[model samples]
Structures are given as structure tokens and as C-alpha cells.
Target: MASGNMTRQPSPPRVFVDVDVQRDFCDETGALYVKGSPNALFRRLTEHAVARGIPIVGSVDSHAWDAWEFGSNDMPAPEGGKPGFPDHCVKGTPGWLKVEGTLPPRFRFIPNVPHAPIDTAVRELATGQTHGVYFEKEVYSLFANSVAEGFLRELSAALGGAPEFVVYGVATDYCVRAAALGLVQRGYRTTLLTDAVAGITEAGVAAALGEMQAAGVALTTASAVLG
Candidate 1:
């Protein structure tokens, strides 16, 4: 039996996962803009995370100009028969960049590659050597990047356990929904900042919220999170 005086180790700080808050999705004039993106709220959330020294793990939709996912491309869809979306977030384009106030001063971009250095990433994230770590994804789901899961697993181990995740960003129906569901499926305690996200359509957002809630993702607002 353990001694009564023994103390339990403190849990790690909650992680803020910003999902695909790029200019194309947030800016009104950009391609594939999400309606009603709360740019001010996004800034506040990012600033709060940085000020509190919380780790920020985020995803960016980085596509090639001629990628199959672009509806302008003639290539066939990989799986479903559905056509692709309008060209958006093409690499090196203005719209591909992250929205203002969403990035930290000290952050690293991890490209989608077969041999990502997961160990190095975990160390940097867990030690606060990097305030934010952003993963590049070609598809709506960050999990589409093969290295993402491995990096996340190692980070969890380094942090002593799986940390609670607070998720936000553009397109509540697509990327944000995929991210929140992915986190919950991996047994992470996930929360979605409802007011901070926008969506392609009202119906989509409503359906996404229901799915997320059913999957054990807590839905709340930025104010609640900040408080």
C-alpha cells in the first residue's frame, strides 16, 4: 500500500488544437471562405493559449495547385465519386497562410512527410521549446497525414498522459468536425469552442455539433474556456 503522504503528479496543461484556420477559410474574399468565421474570437483564443504557455497543436490545409482535391483538376477522386472542392489553400498562395493572430512567435511547421521526426517534435512540444506545432495536411482530416498520429502518441507519453484538448477554428462542419471526432476516438478529452468556429452551411454545422456531442466531445464557448 502507498503512504498517505504520497502526492499524485499534476496533470499536464490543456492543449489548444486549432484546426485549419487559414486565410482561405477565414477571410471573406478568399477562396472557399467559411461563413461567419469569428476572427476576433480566434485571435483571443490564440492569445490566451500563448499567454498561459499552453501548447498549441494545429492543422493547415496545404494543397498543391494541381492536386486532385481541387475541382479544377481533371484527376479522378481517390475514393468517393464526389467531385472535389474549389481550389483553395494552394501551397505558397496568400490564402494558404494561417490567419492573423492564430500563430505564436515560436512555432514550427511539420510538413506531411513519410519520415517525420516524431521524437524531436514530442520533445520540443513537451518542453515548451516551441509554443506551437502546426501539421500540414492535404485532406480535410489531419489524420490523413501519416505522421500525425505517431507524433500525437509520443507527445501524450511525454506529457505523462493524454492532455485535455480545446479545439476551435474555421469550418465547423468539415475540418473542425474531423479533428474533434479524431481526438475523441483516440480517447482524448476534447472540447469544441462552438462560437469560435464557422461553417459552410447552417445544416452542416448543426449536424456536426450533434455528431461531436454524441462522440463525447464537450461543446462550449470561448468565454467559458477563457474563464
Candidate 2:
């Protein structure tokens, strides 16, 4: 369903979108750790959201051992390749868990599977019973998940209007950048929390933040989130 079909109270003014805050990316000993813990701020955001009564939706990267992002793949064709990053967030592993202090009871998960029935998810979301969807992605952009744009459409409905997303998490240069840009492309307003996110390198983070600003994604700090 399109966003207009759902009936509900107007959503809270802010929507907290927590991107891959997984152990594999946020933990100190992770296979592909980002340099810091956004989870500490992420936890505060979750509690803040609850205080304001807003929803917190989290996205995770659930990949096969042979996912294109990994170097350990020994498979063939579409499923096997690498962009030169080390293996991380492999499916069915503890390393893939959301980092400590990030998975509060307020959050809802939408795992990245190869397939998700968008229409069904939309219907469920429209019922006003779900807090949020935990989208999963094999690709960097969460928008590339199996639910595709339908997730946003439904999410808008669930929130009772178009969403104004406050996004944070992981390496500032790659997945986080892709997700922020994707949200803009899909016609949503986005805000990136600087203090709550980390990067692979200082240069990379600066470049990514510059790019996001140029693309109209508001650059702000976690402290700025009043909720």
C-alpha cells in the first residue's frame, strides 16, 4: 500500500534510524571494526526515543560467508566476489549481533533476507502494531533490501506521514553513506548523527560527511537529538 492508505495518529516528529550497529562492525575485536562505539550513543537515543514515544528501527547486514564483500569466498558468479574488505557480519554468527547497549526493547529488527514480501510487510505495518522494521542488506544501502522501497512507503504510513529520519552508525564512508544517499533518493529527509557514528579513517569520514552535506543530509550531533 501507498503511505496514504493507512490511518493512525500522527507519528512522533523524529524517527531514529540505527544503521549496522553490529558487533562485527562496532566491537573492538570485530573482523571489521569501525574505530569507535556509536552504541553508547545509540542506547541513549533509544531511551530518548522512548521518552518522546518515537520508534527506533534498526538495520543489519546479514551476509553469507561468500558475500561479495568478503575475501574468503570460494564460490562462483554472482554470489562470490570481493570489494577487498575482510569478511564480516556473516549470517548465523554471534559476531553479527547488534553491539552492546544498542538492542534495547524499544527497537524492532528487519533482517536482510534475499526475499521479503513487501506487500505483506506493508499491511502489517499499516496495522499500527509494529514499532519498526529491521531491514537487512547484502549491499551497502539498506534501501537495497528485499523489501526495497516498499519498506519506506510502509514505514511512512506506520509513522502516520512521511518520515524525517535521524540516521547513525558504522563506518561513515561506506554503508552509512550509501544508506543516507539512498534515503534522499527515495524522497525522504535525513539527518546524520556525527557523534554517534565512526569511520574507517579521518580522511574518509571527512569526505563522506562532506558528500552527505552536499547531498542535503543534515549533519548533526547525537546531543542535538532532543528526543
- The best candidate in terms of TM-score: 1
lDDT of 1: 0.85
Best by lDDT: 1
- Residue 37 in candidate 2, Cα distance off native in Å: 2.6
Candidate 1 per-residue lDDT, tens place, 1-227, comes to 21233232236658889999899989999898888989988888887776666778999999888878777878777786745788999989999998998888778888988888777777877777777899999877878888888888888777778788889997889999999999999998999998888898889999999999999999889999787
Show where candidate 1 strays beyond 4 Å.
1-12
| Positional deviation of residue 148's Cα in model 2 after best superposition, in angstroms | 3.7
**What C-alpha lDDT do the candidate models reach, one value each?**
0.85, 0.73
Residue runs of model 2 more than 4 Å from their true location after superposition: 1-12, 76-81, 106-108, 111-115, 118-128
lDDT tens string, model 2, 54-141? 5565678888877766666644446444465688888789888887766655334555555656655554444534445578777778
